[model samples]
Target: MDINKIHYAEITISAVSPKQYPDDGLPEVALAGRSNVGKSSFINAMVNRKKLARTSGKPGKTRTLNYFNIENELFFVDVPGYGYAKVSNAEQEKWGEMMNVYFSSRDELSLSILLVDLRHHPTELDVQMYDFLKYYNLPVLVVATKADKIKKSKRNKHINQVIQTLELATEDKVMVFSAETREGRDEVWNEILASTRNDSI
Candidate 1:
């Protein structure tokens, strides 16, 4: 896809329930990650818009499902970041319920892009998110973000760690990404396109 052609993207809704989701029937790619994993930065980089998705210094800032309509061709669903320490138990339960309903029942959901910090191993919540996607038979692309923060020489080792720790299948693709330099942006978009195309079949 031409990155320059993505001129119509915007956040259409911040939904907490199915009734609030868009009814346009566009294929959706959901983004999942732990708190402060650079999901928003990924979205902004993908769309070539600096502030399309708000980036925050604090964790757990995104508490709802943010739907970004990309050129009206598809929707990028930004689910709330998991594994924040300060959130109340009740708030965590609500997030769990909201995510469960969307992941299990949303027919338009074509894929889920699970983002993990490239500088460290996948967190427990990251593993659980991957398992949840697999349990629901949802296609997944695991992205190790913040790649620029690590040395290029050590990147392979970190990527390998992420894969092994997550127990990713041989067929599953994992890309090292950096929102700062836009590294892996094209590859990520390609995966998104492929996933959505497969869903159309």
Candidate 2:
């Protein structure tokens, strides 16, 4: 977990279904968030690679289940971002179908790292996704991204807003993160390592 050490990371696949997933059974962590919520930037931050995950000024740029191989030990599944109105209804429905099939039954999926903007409350879709993950009984690590944009004095207020909006349980782990400053990167990796290594979470 040394940030300075070199790492092997690449886009293993842009899977659209279970058949396309790697069959080796590596524990997987899925990233979920809004269309412009910085999931890609978060991924790059975690791996200490500036462009490991593609960044876009446009929302809904990521359209498939992108699996990133991290040092050949873990898979970071970047699911398509949700809650963008610019995408067509049919396109959204297609993504919905793709996600429902994957999240509902992907056995290797060990953890879900849900991203929420620290500057605002969790949106309705965000709430629904939390409930969906809960329904599946998966352990969640909620990361409030864009932490650098907020002042330290007012951060707790925004963090509280996220917790309250999601009605996060006491055991749920939540923290502020910044891709720009790499804030919370090590802590997030610690959480991921803990969650992925433990069989019972």
Candidate 3:
């Protein structure tokens, strides 16, 4: 299939309770990151469909897993990004529990894209997420978002910091991306395609 032609057809809320996932057979690629880290923008960039993922200047706006069907070939699951301010402790705890079940038991989740800000090294929350994915033995690709914000000379340094901090091996994957500039879209597609081949979704 021509990935460049891919467009977002529909986005439906899936498993608002986090207990109803892994039942859908569609291959799932999950996007995870800290709040305001540009995950929704990344999704919009990936499908070449602007505003489909509903980006907001405010953080913690998305609280549920949104599933988007792409040309009937794969599913893009937008997991709510974590660590937002002004969120109640009870709400945060609930979100944490919901995520725990999703990551641990969702059999249909094939690949997880961990989105981090390219201009800054991964934050503590980002590090925890990387460790969590590793502990689960899941396939993950670190996405350094907003690549255009950093200078060319500084990009490698930031990327190296993320790699070393996560303790990722040379073979482990990471991609630099900018949603506004539409960079790294094709590479992200390639990674998603690779995940689909494993038949986990």
TM-score of each: 0.95, 0.95, 0.92
lDDT of each: 0.91, 0.89, 0.82
State how far residue 112 of model 1 sits from its true place (Å).
0.3
Global lDDT for candidate 1?
A: 0.91
> Candidate 3's error at 41, in angstroms?
0.8
By TM-score, is 1 or 2 better? 1
Q: Model 2 TM-score?
A: 0.95
Best by TM-score: 1
Candidate 2 C-alpha lDDT tens digits along 1-201: 454563798998999888898998889999999989999889888888889898998899888999999887789999989998899999998998998888889988888999999999999999999998888788899999999999999998999999999999787989899999999887888788787775321
On residues 1-201, what C-alpha lDDT tens digit does candidate 1 reach at each position? 466568799999999999999999999999999988989989999998899998887889998999999988899999999998999999999999999999999999988999999999998889999999999988899999999999999988999999999999777889999999999988888888878774221
Error (Å) of candidate 1 at residue 103 is 0.3
Best-performing candidate as measured by lDDT: 1
Q: Order candidates by TM-score, high to low.
A: 1, 2, 3
Q: Which candidate model has the greater TM-score, 1 or 3? A: 1
For model 1, the stretches where C-alpha displacement exceeds 4 angstroms are 198-201
